[model samples]
Target chain A: MNITQLPFIKEIYGFLGHDLVAAVIGILIILVFVPLNSAFLVWVERKVAGHIQLRPGPMEVGPHGILQTLIDAVKLMSKEMITPKLADKFLFWLAPIVIIIPAIVCFVVIPFSPLMQVREMNVGILLIFSFSSLTVLSILMAGWASNNKYALIGAVRAVAQNVAYEIPLLLSTMSIIIMTNSFKMSEITAAQSPVWFIVYQPVAAIIFFISTTAETNRAPFDLVEAESELVSGFHTEYTGMRFALFFLAEYTNMFIAASMGAVLFFGGWHGPFFPGLIWFVVKVYALIFVIIWVRWTFPRLRFDQLMNFAWKVMIPVALLNLMITAIVLKAL
Target chain B: MIAITDIISPVLVARGAFWLMVTITLTGALLAVVPRNIVHNILGLALAMFGITGIYLYLGSQFVAMMQLLIYVGAICMTYIFAIMLSPPLELELPKRRKAKVITAFFVSLVTFIVMAQMILSYKWAPVTSLSRDWSIETIGQQLLTRYFLVFELISLLLAIAIIGAIMIAGLVRRKN
Candidate 1:
């Protein structure tokens, strides 16, 4: 029987019938997947970095250091939680929770498969953009609550970076939405069955990818949390679980952004041979690998340079791409 | 006198729940920006924005709701925190509200809200009867490229200019320092 047809599903169905049940299940899924995904990504990133640096990566700790992240997580959890004496105790505790809430919620509208999406909507693309922007605010909160000079500087850098990049990210996405018309992820994928948008709007695709990376605070664009410059950036004062929450949120966000790029430009869940869902995951992981590669390979852009690239380079390219796509589609 | 079927009505409960969420969101938003303590304001904003996301879910825009949380709560709020952190003035004691400023701002906001609300309520929203019922991502694409092509191009041009301007301004600021 199809999962949608299950009687148990009805128990948790309706607008308000068992929203609590739905929420609980949703949180459960996030909790299970986030840590597992973070572990896998951490291992993958290290291995990738190791190979690039010409050094042997982790060999011990459960099969080529696959268990390293788990060990680290345990160590982190066991450590004492610290709060600066000068900090506002209440807001300090609240900041991390605020960050994680959006990261988890973002997964809701993402179409993992046709049947796998938690909540499908007409405006899926807009939803993702809006929700992702909230991270800036949360980071700012974390920085302020820390009451540390480094944290403050990092938070300021983060705000400037996010605000700068957001324009290009939105513009590039607008090109896709113009080509597709609907903001729904599933619909965008369906439109690409005959031809993926990336084929026609390659420039937009590149802009989207770059802007998304910056948006997620990944390497090269990760000035907010740059260790060498800002001393761990905004979350410098955080310890134990609070810091873990920030880390988990960041990795999960990266996964979500990469997966979204797959859905938008790569014809989500569509491919010949193998199920649609399989194709979707393959594309997503491939993109994720590329992101990791970029992170390790490139030197970080200066904060000013980063802003300039987004506003001057990406935005214009994305706009021109959209215009060209629109005209071509119209003429055809 | 009670009807047996009345207890099971989903519509009533759904409507009630939606209004509750709306109240939570609006209240939270008010708290987020108005509070003297920057931290409290952020919390309030988060709560409010989360509520707005809930409202979006009800409006058949799950995607927008998710985006609202992700972008506003995750990113913008974080930015605000960073701003507070960076600003020395933020560390100062909360100032007492000036009665005149408070009254003027309140009246202006109230008037604006009422006017907008009235206009929205008065407008007639006509559904497109001839168009396909499918507002799926696929159809949106077809329409955007085929029917709304001009508008699409215009938006792109506008975005290009905005980007160039933002870069120039930021670059100038950095160079001066």
Candidate 2:
């Protein structure tokens, strides 16, 4: 049976398929943006790390080391992808793609400019949060499939770390959600026209930023990949292109976390004497810079310290912040 | 269950992408049961949940769809997989009585499917008004607090009572020790 020829199904698709082209175009833009943004961020992270330690980073690669990432990408792609003899081939291959997929899909809801959102849903924030959690599963799969002790240990840490941090992450965001009375990225941004949510929910903002940084597995939350202990954690067995895919996803996730924080706390794309997209980009990069700075300035927390901080410190503070926000909103 | 069928049957009738989601869901269930490996079974359950998230999207509420993903796939599935990773999988086989039970189960499900299909085929579906139906999060929130206020509060009260009872039991155990 030719299903597409079915009259009823055809009618329904006909009714709602008008946006198909536009949606494809939007996805294409995101596809192009993900890699470029990741590469640029990696270059910036290196440059930032270099200057912090008093050295010129990647200056030999190109003028000001701008083309360093491009060369690195080429080097990564050309390298042989080695699969461990004992590795579960199915899960090992699936992990990288699975990790990357949701990170790309998350771009659909993010508003780059007023007119530049891919697909705006009432539950855009939830969509991102939910998929972000899926990355934890991917990390576990990669670690377990590698059949390596270090990899499994790394993956285990990732799951525990993500599960603990996700509470404060959601709680902090809930405070902002209450203030705006909406979860749509556009609405969350628009609600901040008069004053940024950071002004009203500063505590929530701090927790949100910290939790998001942890969510992306950036330092001082990079215990998932704590080089000293786990030897690159869950990705110890990956090689070449497969490793690059994980890197690509990691950097892209860092941007998503930063941009989402911008949308929540900073007035996204809202600034004087500049376009919305420019303001949005500027805010994102600025946050990324701070994240990188924190990475260098701070040391990674131990496993117990990370868990206690999330449960005892971050969760309680975030809950208190939420209660206060709700009470104030009610009284006002 | 009957009311759910009434809601889903109309969307099910539009069988283009709907069928794709259905196939995915069936495949996921099959993977969950047919796999000898426990990890594969867990992942199959996750895949089925993912397919359900798509179906929820098709049913016109992105909120419900994301919540399905967030709660079921994200939290519950993660917990299951994590525990599975920690514990060893069982490999004991059942006795020959399983054949009879499988046959009976198949017949029961087949009869149920027939009855449900008959009901669906007999019913007249109303035209979808997705475009004209303009509802917001605010409206849903208001309805929950006003119309379903008792149910909402009662559920919260139930959770609170459960938590306190658990704590009370723990306190008694500690005191005895």
Candidate 3:
């Protein structure tokens, strides 16, 4: 069903027109969902981390620390916003907003179900990748504006890792694109109604997953915010909500990356009995859970080792997989 | 009091957004030129690229617009910043200008501006009565492979050679050390 056909939406569309109504509704969903979804993910991550370490995390806020992230967000909001005397005032303030808008804007193209999604652009996957790249710029601004050496180092490391991993990420994704012959997220999903891409292209799926983990700065690739080493990395100088914005954007990015993985490999919104939206959510969360599990399971790789792994191992493997898929398809 | 809806109607809002993007592009261009700080210049260029992407969207090529964002805003600008930020600041200050040189530069820029403005004013913008052009990604991909295959491969070869040259230069420096 067309969203404009809905009674309330139709009323709004009459008053505001289709484009305005769509923009307003999208912004509303982003504003409402970003915070709540991020908070929930924070709670989940902490809980998962705790369980992995054989402990219960944050039990005091509510039963099993259910309200912990909410309280934590309040605490962060209430704290002082500090600007270092040496900092570049304009870009320093711009960093968090820059990081966030793109993170949330990515949801515009994400197909939660056949009926859902803010807008279905033709180049859905490219749009997401484009916005994710903007996040790198925000990190650069954050690191540079702060005028801290460690922050700069962390930012530089993060950029290098992201840029390196992005190659393999695109390569793996290209293989899927080759198979589907389309870039629209829903179309890609629909193409897999018969059999999931994971069954056909397992190698691409694994490479894609690993590349996404590094892309999101999740452990053991969490060198961007490595607490023990770089004192929270590029966000070392950020305080209160400013720091929390980065935290929130990180989880949202994880969600976006995981959702892409789900759509590409797991036959998005495709499953037995349950509706499309539920299956989609289940797949997204399942991918996210494995990521979090991997985070706690492994130790962080060394800087050189990380670069080597991306360039030497991941790229060649992903490229070989792409070529093999292409030849196979052409042969068929 | 006058009604607010008259001033802020949906039609006006869409036009206002396009104008906003135009203003952003101009501001970013000015920032890029005026700023003495290299980092600020990079940021401005990045911002301008975003504005240009918006303009591309309005011009009816979503594929090109997204590519502008992906290649320029995302990858290229970030690389430019990384190149500078990771190194010590360069001595980028302009030297004391000679009067003749200043006059020459002024005339060059003025002539360039006049030529561009004249071309823009002379050209006619047709009303978009039909969406005839298929600006799809697949069409573009096919065109590149079939029509522009040699040109694409040449560019790729050039980039590969440049990369090798850069590596050789760096290795030479290390050997000298």
Candidate 4:
């Protein structure tokens, strides 16, 4: 539709108008995509898990269980809402909302295609991280509000694991920011024409991927929701749609993390063939597949082991990667 | 139908959206700290931080925004949750609000927000006249190595020390068990 040629562009260029219409349109796009994408991710995860276990997944639902997620979602919608007797009702109800808000908001700065960004701000990467942290807060709120011992333990483990991994995540990102100079995703993509940053800073990319997996609470880092031990983790007491929100946030976060990996390590939306958006989706889904693969392949790490890995191994490697990148860039 | 021209300018609309985001952030911050329930407070903090991330995007720092989501949403909030989980006593009673302390903190935060807002409103932010428009990742890399080499090196050293310290403290805690 030649969005660049839209009248909104001229107004933005003139610096005399507000792109309210465009902004609303952008927000609507995110609202639609998030729920839809999350639903699909659920189906994908189940199918992947089923295949790994050699079991038929969602065979009863439409066409090889394609409609299973939708049916489950509807069932959840109809189920009774339950609040624990000792729980703080207000915060308990509020937790899921908080978790979902950041998931939706972080997409504001994510550039889907060259012309399809909501807000092509200078600090897109930072915005995503800042908002994404709220999910953790929501997780904490969920655990606290549940008033369950297991939920509390799960929340504690989740937080510690998150904190331990965060340093390396930020450091690896810094290495990229140092390499790119610009915090803007658009600029970072543009900088990688002949060679992607993955080639220049392979170590940072590896650290980034690992840290992000931990960051998103995916396995082997899914200690928070470790089914065998913590039961259901932070959202243990949650039921119905409230429980679904947390589920939605997790999958959404997974998608966002994968998209970030695509944007950072792979040449986000950059390829020789097909459209930019297609390339972007391909890279993102490819990364998502790897995440699922890792999830099914590895046994969950103990909470202590998870924390130690981040503090001891990933952080040092990330720092060293940054240092080497700096030296190489200098020597050149 | 109303003409598209009747609506506010896109830039002004953007500003309005920005103000809306700011309001959401500030209000969320207030809610986060003032709520009697610690959990409510944390949610409020998350909302407020999300708002801040929006502001960062407005300020042209996407990397920082993503980092905000990754670290704060992914890490810090998780830590707060961990604290919540570990401290069982916190669930026994609602955290009592000290009126005097609340009043004082409110005044202080209000004053700070006002002063900061005033300063921002007052300042004439001049664009860097001769700076390259190329805000590419390569430029950041080049600058980090050539111009900001000391800072880069220091950051690495700082990260190294942080790792050692975190491990030592965590290990000590584990050993005490």
- Where model 3 places Cα greater than 4 Å from the true spot, the runs are A1-16, A19-23, B1-18, B90-128
lDDT of 2 at A101: 96
Order the candidate numbers by lDDT, best to worst: 3, 2, 4, 1
**Model 4 docking tier (incorrect/acceptable/medium/high):** acceptable
Q: DockQ for each candidate?
A: 0.25, 0.26, 0.35, 0.29
How well is each residue in A147-266 modelled by candidate 2, as lDDT tens digits? 899998888888888888899999999999988778899999998898998898889989998898889999999998999988999999999999999999999999999999999999
Which candidate do you rate higher for DockQ, 2 or 3? Answer: 3
Clashing pairs in 3: none
| Candidates ranked by TM-score | 3, 2, 1, 4
TM-score (2 decimals) of chain A in model 2? 0.95
Compare candidates 2 and 4 on lDDT and give the better one: 2
What TM value does model 4 have? 0.75
Error of 1 at A153 (Å): 1.4
Please compute and give the TM-score of the first chain of candidate 1 against the native first chain. Answer: 0.92
Q: Please, what is the TM-score per model? A: 0.78, 0.85, 0.90, 0.75
Compose the digit string of candidate 3's lDDT tens values, residues B30-127: 88877767788989999999999987765557778889998998888878876786465544555555789768988998999999999999999654
lDDT of model 1, residue A169: 76
Which residues of candidate 4, in runs, are more than 4 Å off?
Answer: A1-21, B1-88, B91-177
Q: What does candidate 1's lDDT look like per residue over A124-176, in tens digits?
A: 77767776777777777788778898997887787788877787778777878
